[model samples]
Target: MPFTFEPLPIAVAALTFLLAGFVKGVIGLGLPTVAMGLLGAVMEPAQAASLLIVPSLVTNVWQLATGPRFGVLARRLWLMMVGVVVGTLAGTGFMQGGHAEQAATALGVALVAYAVLGLTAIRFAVPPRAEWWLGPVIGVVTGLVTAATGVFVIPAVPYLGALGLTKDELIQALGLSFTVSTVALAAALAGGGTFEAGTAGASALALAPALIGMTMGGWVRGRVSEQMFRRCFFLGLLALGAHLASRTLI
Candidate 1:
């Protein structure tokens, strides 16, 4: 139908997705985090988030499928997932309304905080007994953050990390959590009217480049130093977040 973005911006969006996918491939996360942080610099945060929907859904679904413990994790994390849906639904109005700019600014702040925390050695753990009470709380907060910022990490990621899961189990749990978040965020955006046909088409187009980048990154993962690469990635995110946050100020 009608073109929503010029050729130059489209190219930029494609490249941004590619880069974000590469980061995800290498780190097993950060697709939306990196994509939103970089794309929000060039476009409205809502549009940037909309562009992420398809790729995030596709990749995270793939991630969820590849994990053998999906059934087990799903049973354990259902409440948190439900909370994420409810929270995202509740916050969609503000994200789609006059507070869009404020939401973007909040997203930027979140990015900065996440990057800073990631760069540090800080860690947290959730005792098994606390999951019933704390899981939903964290999920709802994560969902609100996801709705407002289009990034679904923060407390969710840390909370999962605290679950004391094995490396593989942790990865599976993350995949499950992110898949749920992506679906819920898509629903919220649709309800908010931020995800239209044009944006959906653009999001579909971005999937190719993102997948290619992920393939490339997977190849590089075994060859390079993950810790070093992660440090650099967080630093870059910190800078991007600062830029986005500055936009609201200036």
Candidate 2:
């Protein structure tokens, strides 16, 4: 492992994943989003994304398996997952191939859009009749974005929410979708040659603090007012996104 960094950056990475995992433990999502946005400051988007794969994949798998309706949701969402794979592979190297600045700008834009949607709390519905077609479309778009920015919750999360699943089921469904996205992104990164042994080791080491944070967050979830927390979260994301966008565009 020849990667070099001062102790400050290492501390930042630890704190970033800890915080990111805590957020996920509380809200059931946002681990990759938080990690990517914060880590982007100290590393390339591709490298940041590489560091995210292990923690996100392991946590989401746990989320997916803990649910009661795995078979049903798996059957329902397989089409969308396939689309995700296709989109990710098709868009390989878009972010890693000398497009770092554009990728950062795009990452900032993603964070901004997601924050605005969260703050507004707008909701949409998808008729049962439309899921067959719409789901895959959303998955493809999500996968393309994941390929670029390492965030996959955009259209996919909203669409899953619209499916009218119970709370537990929705969380599990998200886990399923995100697991697919993580694996696809790994394949894409590997294909691009950015997912090397040292990078893989870095991602593996991040899992510990992430798990610790998730544990702490699970304890806090029962005590905290999630609404207030979410408001603050989105506001912070808005500011972070704006900072990234401004810093890059300036």
Candidate 3:
């Protein structure tokens, strides 16, 4: 199909990307998660996911490069990456099916769960010996979730947080994981026939606003109390999730 741009959705996509990017700049994550949440409210879940592909890939690549020990981290995470790819491919059928709304609802619930987790001060640790088994498991789960809803959080972020990585390493690891997931997701969407030139164009257009918002957010991060900002951010996510879930249910 040829690309057709609608003024309203384009505006929504631009604004949502900017907001999502701002959140990511301040917090170091939540670009896709926040974008999908807000976009799902207005667009088809698959379309929202499609819109996320370009910006997510580009920013995360930048993130991955700016971090420490890329090769070492990649080597350590190889199995997990493999699992993420395979699982995403396997799960793409859900997004292509008639149950796309269900996927959106699931995304809403996932967002709520993520927000709640963020609000809490819970800490989970993974032992060095356990990474071999846990890594692939978390990867597959994250990939499956991404395939369904275009948001990759849940077990993946938490599991990575459990590993005793330094702050920079954690950020880099997350970027690596998200980058791979974005690529896998784009492939899946293309194969499923849900992403085409039209959506790709919109996704590309959205990149400008997202990058601008990210730059602004980075600047704000230095001025504000991170802890306070995080609290407000999670609270907003909680509300957004509830709203999306309600729409799906009601």
Quick one: ranking by lDDT, best first? 2, 3, 1
Clashing pairs in 3: none
lDDT of 2 by residue, 1-250 (tens): 2234568667878999999888777667778878877887787788888988999999899878888899999999899999999888888977766665676566567768877886885855799888889989988988887887787776787688678787568768989999999999999998888888888888888899898887776666546565665565566566656755665655
Task: Indicate the residue-level lDDT of 193 in model 2.
Answer: 82
Q: Provide the lowest-lDDT 10-residue window in model 1.
A: 221-230
Alpha-carbon RMSD of each model: 3.1, 3.0, 2.7
TM-score of candidate 1 to 2 decimals: 0.83
Kindly provide the TM-score of model 2 when superposed on the true structure, using C-alpha atoms.
0.85
Ten-residue segment with the worst summed lDDT in candidate 3?
Answer: 1-10
Please, what's the RMSD in Å of model 1?
3.1
In candidate 1, what are the lDDT values of residues 1-250, reduced to their tens digit?
2226788778888888898888766655778877876776677777888889999988787767866688989999999999888888878855556766776677668768877886999756777888998999988998888887787876687677678776556657878888888998988888777788988998999999888887787566546565665575567567656765676676
Query: Per-residue CA lDDT of candidate 3, range 146-206, in tens?
Result: 8877877656776776786765677688889999999999999999887898889888998
lDDT of each: 0.78, 0.80, 0.79
